[model samples]
Target: MRSAPRSMSEEVIPLVEESAVVGKREVVTGRVRVRTVTDTIEELAQADVQHETVEVTRVPVGRVVETAPEIRTEGDVTIVPVLEEVLVVEKRLVLKQELHIRRRVEQEAVEVPITLRKQRAIVERTDPEDPAPEGPPT
Candidate 1:
């Protein structure tokens, strides 16, 4: 029997395939951590504080005056006169009483306990690759 020749369109062709590979990995670059710490320190501070107190005393006074006396101060003692008008058929003025205002200043050495605070930064570095620790992160 005679064999027939194949047509151009019927001819078979072999082909090779090429492809790209995709992948992912995890890398430990570094780490950062924050922490808070507290510390105490001693310091000295000076300030002026005022304290007020009152003292009273009485004495006998038997006198009569025409007009009110003027306010005066001697040393740290202040003298103030209280007056009233003695009324008769005619209008009149008379010294009634006196009031004294006194002021005293005293200072005592005192030791005060106070609390102070301060902030400081401390950093440490570590690497998985290195067996020893690095001194600081920076």
Candidate 2:
């Protein structure tokens, strides 16, 4: 430290100079987006399904009957006889007709169309400062 002059006539003047300093830091220049996309796909598939069907047939009974017959079923055939009484000089019963029921089962192969969904992820990074991923370490 130095003292100032006692008189105003005796005074000292000092010279000074200025300069600039530079530094670096990390800044957010761009952004990265990640999202998922869903897609639908169609394909052919196979499955087993069951269906039922019935068949009926008529038979003639041209004979005399005494009483009504009960419903009878066979392996795949059922017989049901219809009876009626005829009024004449001689009161008697007769067989009107009969019904035949036939049932059969069969299997078949069929193709079916099915729908499926698939998902995929997409990542996009846009930054002019860093173009390549392996260019620098994060």
The lDDT leader among the candidates is: 2
Please provide, for model 1 over 1-138, each residue's C-alpha lDDT reduced to its tens digit, 9 standing for 90 to 100. Answer: 987986667666879989999998997676554445567888766666667765544433435676667988777777777766666897766665666667666665555778798766765555656554457333
lDDT of each: 0.65, 0.79
**Residue 124 error, candidate 2, Å:** 6.1
Would you give me the overall lDDT of model 1?
0.65
Query: How good is model 1 by TM-score?
Result: 0.53
Candidate 2: where are CA atoms >4 Å away? 1-32, 120-138
Backbone clash count for every predicted candidate, in the order shown: 0, 0
C-alpha RMSD for every candidate: 9.4, 11.8
- TM-scores of all candidate predictions against the true structure: 0.53, 0.55
Poorly placed runs, candidate 1 (over 4 Å): 1-34, 42-50, 58-62, 128-138
